[model samples]
Target: MVADQFGLRAIPTVYFLQQGQPIDGFQGPQSEKFIREILTHILQTAEELKIAQATELMATGKTAEALPLLKEAHQLEPKNSDISLTYAEALITLNQLDESQKILNTIAIQDQDSRYQGLLAQIELQKKAADTPEIKQLQETFAQQPENAELAVQLALKLHEVNRNEEALEILLTFLKKDLSAGDGSVKKTMMDILSALGSSDPLTNRYRHQIYSILY
Candidate 1:
């Protein structure tokens, strides 16, 4: 009856239940050590679990998805260098360069490992990428013709090319505020593209999307 209730079909089944509901489980004959390890993990604190999950997300190149989790984990464990490094990495991926540098700089000297050095190098690269002469030229052109929807969209597109997505979206949204369907909706189209490129998991993407909604409704 117990097996039937859970719909058990395997001979060796393990289930970790919390609050009368299963939170994790595995099926198969396993060593006692493996089972003990699973139990140990199940007993870990929320902060530990969050950092572990965020690390996995970061490993999979889902930095946007990991950012919030890592941010929470960092808040929970401010003194933890590993968590700080990960949060900084996620920030860099999202182009929050200054914030990322600040976080990285706070790590203790003894805890500054290879990962810390790598993040520093990454910050420099991102800074250099965000300052190309062409982007400057576009900025100048856009400034001279701020009301030109076509020029605004063109400059925004150029910004997007260099991973400056937030700025790209801002330029487009600024134009959209004055003329929602600028250049036959090309401006909104570009905004959508920038947001999409930022990924659904990115907070800025969500925020800007809400701004777009406000413009529409």
Candidate 2:
């Protein structure tokens, strides 16, 4: 039955399922850690779907509607970093900065994940948007020298400061596409920083991450 239902071709096939739907599986024996990771991933995926739905609602200016979804997702996967970040973002959108910061502070300092750092940066930028003069200066420089990679990185960071994340990502992506073979990894690193800020489950992040992987491998 397992072979027929799951297309198992080997003797030691295993399947992981949730609500009767197959999430992941292996065709051979695996380490305990590997199996644990797969199980964790399955749980994470369930929460990710809720976050995606919440994001779509937010994109339509339905922040109030998105909140319940995010809260439910967070509750379902309390240990998931990505879901927690998205939940905090939704709180930010609702002008609940104190609540947002509390969530951000809970994330461990040693994690050092780009997404976590990016969210922290976002909160800071939102708190001091009026006090940042560098943003204006970078904008002017980027306007004058659109092809300068360094300026582009600086400008994109400024744009992200103002929550113009899509524009920021586009700027980095354009530069990376043109300088794919450049010895310096600055462009790629900048792209990853933006992607990590955008969150791992974001479609744009996934798309560009795949593009980078294709180029490197």
Leading candidate by lDDT: 1
Model 2: per-residue lDDT, tens digit, 103-182? 77766657548977777787777767633588778877788988788788777777766655656777777877777743
| Superposed model 2: Cα runs more than 4 Å off | 1-133, 181-183, 214-217
Question: How high is the CA lDDT of each candidate model?
Answer: 0.85, 0.74
- Evaluated with TM-score, which candidate comes out highest? 1
Weakest ten-residue segment in model 1 by summed lDDT: 197-206
Candidate 2, backbone clash total: 0
lDDT of 1 by residue, 112-194 (tens): 99999999999998888788898899889888988888888888898888777767888888888888889799999988988
Clashes of 1: 0
Quote the positional error of residue 191 for candidate 2 in Å: 1.0
Deviation of model 2 at 205, angstroms: 1.6
TM-score for each of the candidates: 0.62, 0.40
